[model samples]
Target: MFKNILLLLCMTALSTPAFAQDHAAQNADIAPDMPAKFTVNTDKFDFIRRDVMIPMRDGAKLHTVILIPKSAHNAPILLTRTPYNATLMTSKAESGTMRSVLQGYDNMPDVIADGGYIRVVQDVRGKYGSEGQYVMNRPLRGALNHTKVDHSTDTWDTIEWLVHNLPQSNEKVGIIGVSYDGYTSLTALINPHPALKVSVPMNPMVDGWMGDDWFHNGAFREEMLSYIYNQDATAKKTAIWWGNQYDNYDLFLNSISAGALGKERGMEQIGFFRQLLAHPAYDSWWQQQAMDHVLADLPLKVPTLLVHSLWDQEDNYGAIALYYALKQKQADQPNLWLAMGPWNHGGEIKEASTLGPIKLPSDTGLYFRKKILEPFLAHYLKDDAVALPQRVSAYRSGSDDWETREALPARDCTTDCTTLHLTAKYQLAMNGSAETSGSVSYLSDPAHPVPYVQRPVITRGAANSAWDNWLSTDQRNAASRPDVATFTSPVLTQPVSLDGQPLVHLTATTSGTDGDFVVKLIDVYPDEVPEQRELGGYQLMVSSDILRGRYRKSFEHPEAIPANQAQLYQFRLPIMNHTFLPGHRIMVQVQSSWFPLYDRNPQTYVSSIFTAPPEAYKPATITIDTAKSWLTVHTADVATP
Candidate 1:
């Protein structure tokens, strides 16, 4: 009966006049009349924009964008090669002014406009508008990468083209960028082109395994999965990881292990994700890609400026590590310089007068651009430009001032390091020993790991997310946790300043076969603030780091930690030039897990934490021997302005 009714309806619809006309219209052939291309006239603009594809050593052609000022003649070329879209970076706003068009990442608009530089931005090979295969932080042409081409070769070819093709260029080029673009700038230093005069690598990704975007001291940064999925899954970054809920902490906590979450999210399709799972430990694969180690052996020809941020949430280790690595070989080479600012990742380009609740005396980003960056670039890329005086420009927090010195640590605190001992009574001491040789124990459950930030944790890159400045946030959230052990010092009688990396020496024991340890050094504010009332009693994190127990002895090798046995673990935290002002107290908190930010340790002995099963996650008792543990902080008597 249904088939008969359907046949009768179809026959009645076929007989209708409207249905017949619609069918005839669908069958009719319409001529295609769209234009093949469109043109953009920029004659009235202050700068002439050109889009071209520059060929690499291989057959790949990278998309390049060049912006020349209206009166540009013999101007220095400032190049920035990035995986990010060049078109977006160059054309940020639709305006007649050149500064309006180039106002995004890596382009200091005021400085660029004032310096009269021939600006150039390009898409790295295999990214947007570039033709080639994409590899995540592609290793140099070596054992890890069997291919003959790499970022260095591509940068060299790009510089060669820029010098020959542009008549307005002065034949001198300076490369500057932040993060991944900074990494590309470092690549150019390996075998620099003759035209390349200066290189500014600001917050670069030097080592992913040690302390960078990917991992920190053998702990996998699981939150970076979203970045890898979005970046490597597609050429134009169309693949975005959207969480079903608002809180990323709950989303990650419910997803079991990082490996399981990746599988559920279809991250198995990304080559970098597969590589990450395969190499859980620091092996040749990661060691070969470490730029600091790679550049240590190479000759330093270009005048390179290493820019670092005190509160950089990403790539914080790159600039500092590379600075030290290059300093080891800087006896005769005086071309290397270092600049440390009070900003977050890429915050040097933005208005850095304030970071989170902390306020600076001035716009530190603008100060750096005008005083340090502009002068350095002009001296190298232009003719008869005055040379910069200082080799190191470090911004000292707490005092809210900038210091120019000949070398870092300004003054060496190696032999005069201040040692803060942890006591059994939960106090930090400068001279006294432990009142009792007792130990502090806490339950570390994989099921209820401590959140890295406050509740309702949002994913990185999300709108209004605090991922960029979480390091500078208040640490009272973690200190209040029962699972975390806190040690506090009395209010400072005088100002105490730290000039170098703080060394963490811990003697700990875990009931489970394996575990992890996170140590944070924080600055506690006074109970009353006259200026910013909300900042009263604020606890700001100064320096912190984590160490995986399995790789405590060797980063390259992994072993099961002996259960219920005391073992010593030592590692250096990030460098800091902060001061504990008068009336401020210093606090240190120790915990087992920094979850969702880093993958849960499971607390059980597993060959690879990435592939650990649910059964491996067991609650374990962690003990800290207060008598044996102490934090070694380098103290410097910085001369305040």
Candidate 2:
């Protein structure tokens, strides 16, 4: 078992390496020199790096890497804890602790190169070199028990140990991380050590059900299944690489079954996968896993900087939801601030200014790091008073400029509610006449689920580059599908800007007992678009969401819908800061399934969707009542682009 775990860890390195496939030459048998280039300038710097096992409160030792610059006079400490290996190399190259130690500082961001600080990175319990069992987004403990310790205690112990043991320490410490690492950074804030003065939890995993990793508004995230298991030894004996299949949609539909995933694929061996299978609904188990309750109750001991991307695939709702939760506690003068951009996942920290073909207004990642992140850390940790961003600093997609606000959603921004009715003629009209009342219907067959993206996709996990840019990819591929119902507004004569979330209300009836409704708000480019651009007639999905019919009334208690009965289902899509320019058209697409992106809804009600049999899958005709079904959008009159 030990040998198998180590083999898995060494094989499936940090999710998917952005370098692996790109450098794989057409005829070359050997892979490229990736490990050497992962972290550059290591030889030029006098930073002394060491690997150590730090004992936690429970006597379990966590594998940690400490790097202190030899030229440092007195420096502050910055710590990041990650489930991904603390060192750089991909899993294929990770041989042993000795190999990683010899590699020196690899895969760290360039900002650290201008270091006047002590940097530390560590693997959480049960991951990589750390000892003890691993738990996904472990729940916060109420009080410390002698028998057990949570992530909070582990963090406090690590910080306490670092402050005392490390020389040339100024005692002040800061924390920051992205994705899973971001979760650890956020966890460190719960009863934080006195020396921990500042933090930036960028794109943290806040909740599983609400719009992060696993589930989105009760809809199962199918792509994450292969992601979670392959990345960790807790789930699989070794990483399962589904080689570059020409058509991923067909690959998933024909190969994987949500009901039989555990029985057929041996997913039962994975602890968290077992727990996910057991709890289909948002029950006590999921509630206990939620971080919102814990975040709202936290004392504002350290000033926090919440960084997020407007298009973050993994944790889009995390930073926003956390901002709202933190605001509830600090209504008077909040210490929490937000910096949002059009980056993917942790792209705000990377050098990428463009996602796919959509170019950002400016170098958002660099601006945030220099103007917001660095200033915030320096001010709190090093007593450096620099002009840092205040309250909210968000990038406006259409305008291509950063907008600062006193609060998120902008305090002074007035919303003009516009309703686009789902018309009988397969059109989205701003105003509907009495005679235009009719229904539009489509057959939603479970055997042929709708594909979320164009097929032949080479990537697998959400951590990969492809998954990061899928949110803004052109939706024209799925638009022509018979299963997808697209309603479009005539080309616009004036510009329309949206600053907040959109609400999708539908009065619909299905042929089966259960179904999923996917709503997408799109901006259609003009026909005479530039050749090099994202293009004319490009359908960019600005905001989208899915609602499981059974959970319409309550997420905790799901009830099957009455077949052929008109039921009103409504849910808010993720927020956006996009503007539909003149000569563009607004489109609303309604569909039953998003394919492998989300697990196919059985359409027939069962005890649990995860355990439903193959026979339960059926075809269903969904009809949208024209008069009652309309998408409500929040638009602002501001025309400054």
Candidate with top TM-score is 1
lDDT of each: 0.89, 0.77
Clashing pairs in 2: 13-91, 246-456
For every candidate, C-alpha RMSD to the true structure in Å: 3.3, 11.3
lDDT of 1 by residue, 1-641 (tens): 99999999998987898877888898786655776786767778889999999998888999999999989999999999998899999888668888898887788898787789999999988899999999999999989888878999999999999999999989999999999999999999988999999999999999999999999999999989999988999999998888897988888878878898998999999999999999988999999899999998898899999999988888889888888887777644578988989999999988889977877789999999988998899899888757784798998888888888877652234676888888888898875643636788899999999999887889999987779889998888898888999999988888988778888889999999999999999999999988888889999988898999999999999899999999988998899988889899989999999978899999999988888898999999999999899888777767643
Least lDDT summed over 10 consecutive residues: which range in candidate 1?
407-416
Q: After superposition, how far is residue 493 of candidate 2 from its true place, in Å?
A: 1.7
Collision pairs in model 1: none
Per-residue lDDT, model 1, residue 463, is 83
Separately for all candidates shown, the number of backbone clashes (residues 3 or more apart, or on different chains) is 0, 2
